[model samples]
Target: MLSIRNLHASVDDTEILKGLSLEVGDGEVHAIMGVNGSGKSTLGHVLAGRPGYTETEGSVQMDGQDLLALEPEIRSREGLFLAFQYPVEVPGVTNLEFLKAAVEARANHRGEEPPNASEFLKQARALCDAVNLDQAFLRRGVNEGFSGGEKKRNELMQMMLLQPKVAILDETDSGLDIDALQVVADGVNGLRAPDRSFVVITHYQRLLNFIEPDYVHVLVGGRIVRSGDKSLALELEEKGYRWLEDEVA
Candidate 1:
């Protein structure tokens, strides 16, 4: 469903991605693993059109559309979602309000009607239950005063509600305890479908244990240095990125 070719991006005048390329077909879940400074998160942010990250080369297509040519909102409207590694707190906006607006906008984009308040609330509460979040959280500000695990859960909630065609989760496993991790994984697994795809960016293979990616990729030096199936994750966990250093070089 998504194709990236020769993607070269930079931040603050320093190039961070060099000739990076990958393809994620419909119903595929691809896991990206690498050490710090290897551009795992950069690739996610670049795909989502994060501000100040300049793309000097390469093309990305969502389905058949020119993904990079659209504005960030347009990208969202076109069914691309990026779950942040660090979900920011917006103290004034209640979670319910934010989610309603987001859902409505996405609905409008697809020429569908927004759900009634009661129906929306019911769905939101059900998603909360699925993600193991308290129903009262809808009254709180976005990520405000939430613990680390709570923030990650909130991100997954957004992903579930948004229901994008291609979801890019940038280290959704970070800071989550075993219990929280399982809950979050369940949220992701529940949303799997034949028409959807996921790009899971993580540093460790532990996340894969829950989500079970269809493909695994090793990203190093701003490029993908290796690609394999789930067994690759286990191998990386055992051998470590040290062995890949020489291979990437």
Candidate 2:
């Protein structure tokens, strides 16, 4: 459902994504593994249209629509979700309020009616349970006082509630403990459907143990170098990126 072709982007006059290309089919989860500076996070930022990552070349499309042409909010409304590597804090906005606004925005964009308060609360509470977050979190400021694991869980909570067609998770596995990791993974697994797809960006293969991706891609030098199945993750865990670099060289 998502296609990226030869995407080149730069930040602060330094090119990060050089000829990067990846295609994620509907319902397929793809894992991107690379060493530091390989542009795993840049691909996510560029796809989600975060400001400052200027696309110098190529194109990204979501189901035939020009993805890079749309504004960030429009991208989210168009069924593209990015779970940030470092979820930021919104001091005054409660988590419930933030999620409600996001839900309403997407609904309005899709020309659907917003959920009534009762329906919203019920669904929101269920999402909280799904991510193993306490109901109290719904009342707290968004990520303001949350620990690293809590922030990651909250990101998963957002992913579950939005139900985007294509979700890009940038290092969602980072800082998560084993239990929190499984909780996040369960949230992802529960949302799997024939019409949904996922791009899971992570540094370690441990995440693949819980949420097995349909394909595992090794990104290097700002582009994808190799695409393989789940077994590739295990191999990378054993051999490291140097093995792939040698092969490419």
The candidate that wins on lDDT is 1
lDDT of each: 0.94, 0.93
Determine which window of 10 residues in candidate 1 has minimal summed lDDT: 240-249
Candidate 1: residue pairs that collide: none
99-141, model 1: which lDDT tens digit per residue? 9999999899889999999999999999898888998999999
| Clashes within 3 Å, all models in order | 0, 1
- Residue-level lDDT for 209 in candidate 1: 99
User: Any residue pairs clashing in model 2, and if so which?
Assistant: 27-196
Stretches off by above 4 angstroms in model 1 are none
lDDT of 2 at 162: 91
lDDT of 1 at 3: 97
lDDT of 1 at 9: 99
Candidate 2's TM-score: 0.98
